[model samples]
Target chain A: MSTAVLGAMYEGIKHIFKHTFTMKYPYQKVLLPKGFRGRHLLYMDKCTGCGICAWICPERCISMVPVTDNKEYPQNPEKRFPQYWYARCCFCHFCTEYCPTGALDYTPDYELAEYDRELLLWSPERLSRPPTNIGEYQSVFHGKDGNQGVTFEPVIKQKSK
Target chain B: MTTEPPSPGISISKTAEPSTLDVSVGPQHPGSGHCRILIRVDGDYIVSADPDIGYVHRGCEKIAEYRNYVSNIPHLERPNIADAIHLNWGYVLPIEELQGVVVPPRGKYISTIAAEMNRIMSHLYGLAIMQGVFSGHTTIFMWAFGDRDLFIELAEMLTGARLTYSFLVPGGPRRDLPFGFEDRLSRLLDYFEKRLVEYDRIFFSNPSVIARAKGIGVLKREDAKKLGVVGPVLRASGVKYDVRKVEPYGAYADLEFDIPTFEEGDSYSRYLIRFEEMKQSVRIIRQALEKIPKGPIARKAPLVAPEGEATGRVESSRGEITYLVMGDNSDKPSRVKIMNGSFRNLIALPFLVRNVHVADMPIIYGSLDYWPVEADR
Candidate 1:
């Protein structure tokens, strides 16, 4: 009985020298993997005004609205694009998958917090900009002494498309 | 000031005996989720426990009617977020049957791997929160949760999202195994196998935890059979019943693994049952990765289903989850009924919680690994 208790104590004490597992969120962030279902990135040139995204969206968060932009697209003669309401979107990526023209793609931009409810809605123009807050740290494991620890390494940013 | 009499339909009278006191354990978060156990206790001993559930009811069945077959994947899986793949798989099986869609051999293998990985994650969540924290062992809780996140990262690598992976569609898994996935998974398993030894030394074999759990809530084999408990709870009671073994699904028929069982139906055995199952899950995943065939992962299934009612069952981390779907030759189902393990195991809660100490209540509750949200849904 004494040995068992001492064994448990020894295991607990052994971890004192090991590296910590958790990260300091907001300051330090672990890089997300490829094909992460974060936010939508729309390509204006590829979009053909097909409402398949809006129709297939389970939450009905995507709505194809007419863009009054000055830029003309030969593919999208109707000038209609999908505008997303982030509040209603479940990020299931069904919209991105069902888009026939491959116009919608996934970007690793999960920080969608907004103060006002109205600001949660993203227009086609807003969705077109690249994500700015992609983290640079990747979680890597050290192989020595069976001491499981994460070491951050520099990440090469890849285009979401 | 005048005190108003009790309302006509409501009874304000005390239900407990003169010596016993009625204590409501929760309508709030009671370690697990929102579930209130109205226990009638005399001194330190509880005479009876009546579980008050339905606090997290979201009318999942009713809402399933409004959505199409594909959309129901995300919605139905909300009941058990920890074991989302199993729940999602259970809902899809019936739709696939109704649509007459068979997943390819490779798709079955991938789904099997994903499901087994999910089983490990779900069991780890139970170990961290249910057993570890309830037993007041903070170290095990931290260790288990940290280990679980490694699996979560791999899950995110395979499926797009981390937890609520709508990875399983009607025909098969959404994505194939990523590059270097096999090597990474095998390495993680090796590290996890070492960790399990430390877990056994610190938590399972530890005297304090064993003393608290060993003979606390002994449900005999006959009683377990009579109660119709499913999953690890039933298996711990020495019933060699598992949906995977009974009605083989995915690549379970192709793989070789044992359904770990314990003779003792106590809280300790329940805890050990999950531990053993995790090892078996590891074995299953390794075998699946090795024997995986190279072929088309998914077959293109039709959006609509024919007019028929089909029932499909999958062994979830908790227990057997059976989904009954009735389609009317439309995109949406006419009716959907879910019979999940948590709700089925709820009867065991009131049965076991009786005649035990008030302090022993949490240990027994945690041993069952009952998720209130899943039960209420």
Candidate 2:
């Protein structure tokens, strides 16, 4: 009985020497792996103004709206583009897959917090531009054998797709 | 002030010796998740435990009726967030049967890997919650959560998302295995195996946990079968009835892994069963990764299905999750019924809590691995 107690205490003390598994947010951020489904990045040039993304959305979060200033394309005369209400979007990336023209893609920018509810809505113009100044730290495993711990390693150069 | 009269067939009586007090443990308490348990206690011993479920009911079945079959994947998986892919598979399996879409061998293999990964993740989540419930040991809770992230990372690499994969579609998974997935998975699994040893030493084999858990809320094998408890809780009672073995689905048919069972039906046995099952899950995953065939992940499935009702059953991290889907000629399903393990296991709660001490409430309740949101849905 005493040995069991001592063994448990020893295990607890052992973890103290091991590196913590937590990420210190803001100062040090772990880089998300490739193909992480996050916010949508729309390619307006590739888009034929098709409403497939809006139609296929499970949450009904995307809607097609008219963009008057866009350059005219032979395939699309309506000049309608998708405007996403991020408040309702589940980020399932079904919209990205079903878009036939390869117009939609997901960026690894998941940190989309806002003080106001209305600011959560991303317009066609906003969705067209990719997120910047993100993802530098890569999660690296520290320790040998079965007693392993996770730590973040900072990347020297920025990653580009 | 006015007092209401008693209803018919009910009598209020003051006992001769001592009064039985009623204690309500949340629809909002930290220990009980989203559901309330009203316990009638005679001094320290509990007379009865009435589980008040449905605190987080979202009417997922009723809502599935309105949405199209393809779009309902996200809504159906919300019931159990930790094991979303299993729920997704259960809902999608019937639709795939109705639509006449046969998943390729590779697709089956991929789905099996994802299911096993989610099983480990779900069990770890359950263990973390169990630690919080019975022992309030933050060490185990934190360690479990931290270790769970490893599997979640592997899952995120395979499927795009971290938590709600929605990776399982009608016919097969949405994506194929990513590059270098096998090597990373093997490394993580090795680390997890070592972590399991630490878990046994620190939490399971700890003297305090053994003292609190052993011989408390003991359910016999006959009583377990009689109560129809599901998942690890049932296996702990030595039932040996797993849906993976009984009606094999996906890649589980080809897999060679044993269903771990314990003769004793106490809380410790239930915890041990889950611990053993995690090891089994690791074994199954490694086998799947090695033997996966090269082929197309999915066969094209139509949005609409023929008029027929089909049921799909898969062993979820909880237990057997069965989905009965009735499809008309339209794009949307006519009716969808999801029967998960949490509600079935909930039947044993009142039965097991009887004649046990009040302190043993968390042990019995947490041991069942009951998720109120899943039960209510």
Candidate 3:
């Protein structure tokens, strides 16, 4: 029993000098993979107002709204676009898969926290705007255990993608 | 008042018997999850334990009737989101059989990878919870959860979601392998392998843990089968039954892995079984990645399935997960019944806890690895 306690303590102390596993969230963030599904980014030009994304959403979070801007999308006569309610969105990205026009895409901006519930709903115009101040951190593996430790090198990027 | 001499080996029923205290251990207890256990105790020893489940029941089967075939994927995986791929496969495989949609060889390989990844994650999560229960060993708990993040990160890289993948569609996986996946996976596997050794030295080999767990809740081989316990609990009781081994599906038929079983049937053995399973999962992942072939990931599936009832089964992280999906020739399924492993294993809970100390309750409970949310669902 005494030996076991001492061994466990040694194991714990061994990690003291090793780098911490957690990312310093607001300051340092994980570098998400290429195909990460985070926040919805809408392309108004290629959308074609089909509402396939709205139809395919299991949560019924996406609704088709009439487009007021005719100058931006001259080809679209349907005068409709998708407005997303983030409150109900499960972020399954099923809509992205079902989108035939390839207009619906996801940006790796997972931080969707807001002060008000009403502000959670994103209009087509709001969804079209790109994400700002995205944090990208490079993961460096150190130590021989393969599990020994990881150090995150924070790489701040201006572009969302 | 003079007391009569205690009967040898047996006690006769009397008009006025010694009263046993009934203590209800939670719907609110942090250790017990959403389910409650009503225990009848004679002093410190439990006389009887009755599990009261269904706190988190959301009528998952009933909800399956309203949604279309594709839409049901996300909802079906909700029962045990940690092992979502297995649940996803259980539901999708039946739908595939009904629709005659054959997943290609590559798709099978990828599914195997994702399933194994989910299994490792699920086992780690269970171990973390079990560690917490075993004398508040917060070190192992933190280590397990921290390492679990590695697998979760891999899952997110592969399937695009952290918790609910919804990656598997009826025909095949929603997406193919991403760039730099194999390299990242191999490194993580090596690290995880080393961590397992550390875990053994710290938690499993700890003297205090063994004293509490060993011979505490011994479910004999006969009793295990009789009680209909499934998963690690069943395996720990010496029944070498794994649905993957019995009926191989997807890439499991082609792959090679051993089903770890223990004869002891104690809480310690159950803990060991999970660790062994995690190691096996790692082996399976390495093999699948090495032997993965080049082919179409998915076959073209129809929007609607035919009118028929088909059953699909898979070895989930917990145990055998079987799905009975009945399609009414519509876009939606007429009925979907999910038989999860946790519910099947719950029958042994009362038997195991009986005659055991109140302090050993958490160890026995955690050994069973019963997820009340999955059971209730």
Candidate 4:
């Protein structure tokens, strides 16, 4: 009987020491695994917006919409961007893979936190253009069309994810 | 203000012979689906028990028939979102097998890896539920879910999606292992293995868990056969049957892992068996990841299927989930019937619960781990 109590106490100590794998997620960022698929990145010039991406989307997250009068922005009057709805997205990532042009690709960043239900909705202006890496951007500080460099100091913590 | 109605008289009449008292356990069960068990007791022992089911009657089969084949892939994931990869892969098999689409070696290997990882997550969740309901240790439950987030992170990386990934297409797996996947998976495997020992110390060897479970809910080898329990529960009862072993799918035949068995046939045995099986699954995944020969994850084919009936079954997180698909030369299937292990294994609960106390009911019911959605489908 004494041993039972002693054993229980000892086991309690051992158990506490044994279970040292507690993950602090929200506070300390978790390292995303390699090949962890997140949102879609479409290169508009490469993507024809061919309905293939829309057809292949199992969750129907991908919708090809006309650029005019869309949810995000009416930028670029001539062309339309892919209107993405994260609400219905199952993260199947089929749209990025099935795009006829190698326009679509995936990123490993998945910390997608939003407050408003409307904020969750990404318009074409929000998602249509491809994500050129900061390294690949070739002077992100420079303005487009031969203007002064898009001058900016890393002001806010830019969480591309 | 409206007054509440008075309580009705509740009494347990003791006759010269044995009499029964009814105890019902939930439609709002903490587990995945809504399932209840009604136990009729006599003097601290169960006289009879009825396994109540059908709280989640989504009519997935009926819906499957109405929806197109392409549309059905996402629809099939809802029964248990935890092991969505297994469900997606299972449904894809019949279509892939029927079409005879040539899948590369890597494509098949990737499916096996994804399916096994998803299985580990499911079993982890199940074990936590077992510990929670049987012994009332919530830390393990919270721990299991917390660790599952890591795998979910890993899953999001490979498929470019998180919860319900349509990574498995009719021809092959959708996405290839991303750059540096092998290294990341190896690290994750090491992490999962380290945690397993902690689980053993905190859960398997804990005295309270042993007292609550251990010898309770014994299933004699003969009784297990008669009851037709499947998967780890059946394996623990000394049955050497596993769908993955019997019917080799994907890279299961190529991979090597011993099927753990224990003749004790108690709730404790079931728990240990699953724990051992999880280790073996981890090993198999490591092997699959290491030697996953290079090739495309999917094959290019023309749209839609020609007419024919096909069936595919894969061991789900809960149990074996079978998909019966009928292609009608259109985008939609004629009918899709799903046979989940939880649905089938639950029928034997009434016999198991007899003579057990009302307090033991939750533990015993939870040990069997039957999901209501499996049956409702």
Candidate 5:
């Protein structure tokens, strides 16, 4: 009986010294894959107003509108397009995949927790721009010379302490 | 494969024979899709199994005669929802090759990456179903399905659709990655890797589960060769014949990952192989995400409406999905024939199940991850 009690006590003490596998994720961010799916960015300038993305959407989250960029250039048919609210985005990367000029793109930021719905509504400004010093191909369809508008994805640099 | 079913069999004397039972598993079985098997059993063991297929048959080939080439894309997607990228590429590849559509390097990379993710989910679904059969734990199914949402969400963000995404055209994919896609995908990958450990803890490492699976329904490499079972099952049986390896598609040649194998060919070996495959899939997806070149998701469809017949053979979740499409230069397909792996497995089930006890039926059947609707089609 004494040996059994001592064994239990020893096991408990040993357990206390063991390392924990769980990480405090919310408090401290975990390492992410280099290419993860996140939110959508629609580059209004590069958008051709083609409805293929919307038509191909399985979830029916994407929609097109006649909103004006700065409400200027009313006569330019190409100037008006919809402001995609990515809060409902499925992140299939359809817009980015369908963009003719390589304008639409996917970047590695996936966190979309928000306090308000209004913040989710993004138009041209929300569309991704080319990364610094990356190559860009200028063509109707994203071409071989670094797809029309796709900017180079830089190697992920760890945050400095 | 079973002796061609002996035509006009002569009956044996009933007075001297033991009693045999007739059991019919349906085109409507909850565990299965559209294939029905009528099994002849003597006491606890199955004697002969007759497979009745075409339950979910939508004559894609017949319909293709009226529709145009562009319209057949959705029809192709109906066969396998788990590995949609493979199907997408399968259909696009022939067109790309034939029409002189040299997709940008970025396009090939995206196809390769997306297909690997789809393959992971497909294999996960296969393993989950097997787990459900061996033990009544649907937890892995829920987990696998839940994680599938991540890939679905990823695909949706990329192509604007979850299941029937027409994102991959002949030239290339439809769009580029969404802004901040990497951040979310990175986090998701971490989450997926973490879940993989949990899967190992709960499903793969469970002793009772292992006992139930270890040596059941084994297929010898020789027999598998004769039967022509594809995908991980054949690989699990010590055969290293993968469509990706045999005929390198998209950017598969460029990516680095192992095609996991096991020589046992038992149910346990298959389960383990699939689990390892999930890990490899993560590796492949990570590589694609990291090295995905900045480029156009797709090239323009080189040949606009044309009369052509193209066979899109893809490696689906089940195994090899052969999509035969014919076009008449219109916007739609002239004919489409979707041949799925589940049908092939269903055909060979009786051969595998012969003399096995009734208790082992679910484990044996579920281990194959046969999708009925796909088979019926």
Candidate 6:
């Protein structure tokens, strides 16, 4: 009984020297993988106003509305684009998958918290902009014990379009 | 004080005993999910327990009727987010059967691997919150949760989302194995195997934990079979019945593993069952990864199914989950019924909590790993 108690204590004490598993969020962030289902990145050139994305969305968050901007979209003759209501979106990315023209793609921009409910809605213009807050820390296991930790490395940012 | 004559509407029973007091143990969050157990206690001992469920029910079955076959995956899986793949797979299998869709051997292997990984993740969650925190061992909770994230990271790499991975569709898995996935998985498994030894020593083998759990809530083999408890709960009671062994699905037929059972049938055995099952899950994943054939991951299945009914079952981390789907020659299913483990195992809750100390209630509840949302759904 004494040995068992001591054994448990020993295991607890051994972990005191190892690196902590948690990250300091806001200051330090773990890098998300390539195909992470976060915010949507809409491509203006590829979209043909098919509305398949709006049709396939389970939450009915996507609505194909006419682009109010004067900018001419030659690809979209009807001038229809998907406007997303982020509050209702479950982030299933079925919209991205079902889009016939591959107009929608995933962006690693998960921080979607807003102070006002109205600001949660993202227009086609807002969805077109690239994510700016992608983190650089990648999780890596090191040492003989295979203790998991994160390492910081600079990432080459790619244009969303 | 003068006793009044009893009215015609109100007749008092002479044999009625009022020694027991009824106490409600939360529709509030009881460590795991929102579930209230109405326990009738006679002094320090509980006389009986009645489970008052449906606090988190989102009507998953009814909602499946309105949504098309594909869209139903997300909400159906929401019932138990920890074991999402199994719930998703269970629902999809019936749909595939109805539509006459058979997944390729490679797709089957990938789905099997994902399911096993999900099983490990789910068990780790049970170990952390259900077993660890309930047992009052905070260390195992932290360690298990921390380790679970590693598997979750790999799951995110495979599927796009983290918890609710709508990875498996009707035909097959959504994505094929990613680049360097096998190597990374093998490395994680190696780390996890080593961590298991430390866990056994610290949490499982700890005298305090053993003392608390060893003899408490002993569900004998006969009682277990009679009550129809499923998964680890059943296995712990020396009943060697697993849906994977009895009715093989996914790549379970191809893989070789053992169903670890103990005769003790106590809370400790229940806890140990999950630990043992995690090891088996690791074995299953390794075999699946090794034997994964080179082919296309998924085939294009039709959006609609013919007018018929089909049933499919999978052994989830909690227990056996069976889904019944009826199609009316439309994109949406007419009727979808789910009979999951938590609800089936809920009968054992009130049965075991009886005649035990009030403090022992949490340990018994946790041992069952009863997710109220899944049960209520």
Among the numbered candidates, top TM-score falls to: 1
lDDT, each prediction: 0.90, 0.87, 0.86, 0.70, 0.64, 0.88
Per-candidate DockQ values are 0.66, 0.74, 0.59, 0.18, 0.04, 0.68
TM-score, chain B, each candidate: 0.96, 0.95, 0.94, 0.91, 0.89, 0.95
Clashing pairs in 2: none
The number of the candidate with the highest lDDT is 1
User: Going through the candidates in order, what fraction of the true interface contacts does each contain?
Assistant: 0.65, 0.78, 0.69, 0.31, 0.00, 0.69
lDDT of 6 by residue, B142-195 (tens): 999988988998999999888999998889998888898899999999899989
Q: Distance (Å) between predicted and true CA of B92, model 2?
A: 1.5
Q: For model 2, what is the alpha-carbon lDDT of residue A85?
A: 96
**After best superposition, candidate 6 residue B239: deviation in angstroms?**
0.9
* Poorly placed runs, candidate 6 (over 4 Å): A145-161, B1-17
**lDDT of each residue in B235-320, candidate 3, tens digit only:** 99999999988989989989999999999999889999999999999999999999999979998898799999999999898888
List TM-score per model, in order. 0.95, 0.95, 0.93, 0.80, 0.67, 0.94
Return the clash pairs for model 3, or none. A146-B191
The order by descending lDDT is 1, 6, 2, 3, 4, 5
Chain A of candidate 5 gets a TM-score of: 0.53
lDDT, residue A114, candidate 3:
98
For residues A40-148, write the lDDT of model 6, one tens digit per residue.
9999878999988887788789898888888888888888889999999999898888888889999889999999999999998999999999887666776764754
Cα lDDT for residue B143, candidate 1: 93
Computed on C-alpha atoms, the DockQ of candidate 1 is 0.66
> Rank order by DockQ, top first?
2, 6, 1, 3, 4, 5
Interface RMSD of each: 1.5, 1.2, 1.7, 13.6, 13.7, 1.3
* C-alpha lDDT of candidate 4 relative to the true structure: 0.70
Q: Candidate 4, residues B1-377: lDDT per residue as tens digits?
A: 89945323212222323366566666665644376666667889887776656667787778776655656777787777767887887788887766677678888998898888888887887877754644688867866775676677677778755577777777787678877667767777776787776677667777777888877788888988887777777888898988888898888889998888999988788778878988998999989977788756778754567789889988776667788888878777787777777776786677777777777766777777766665776
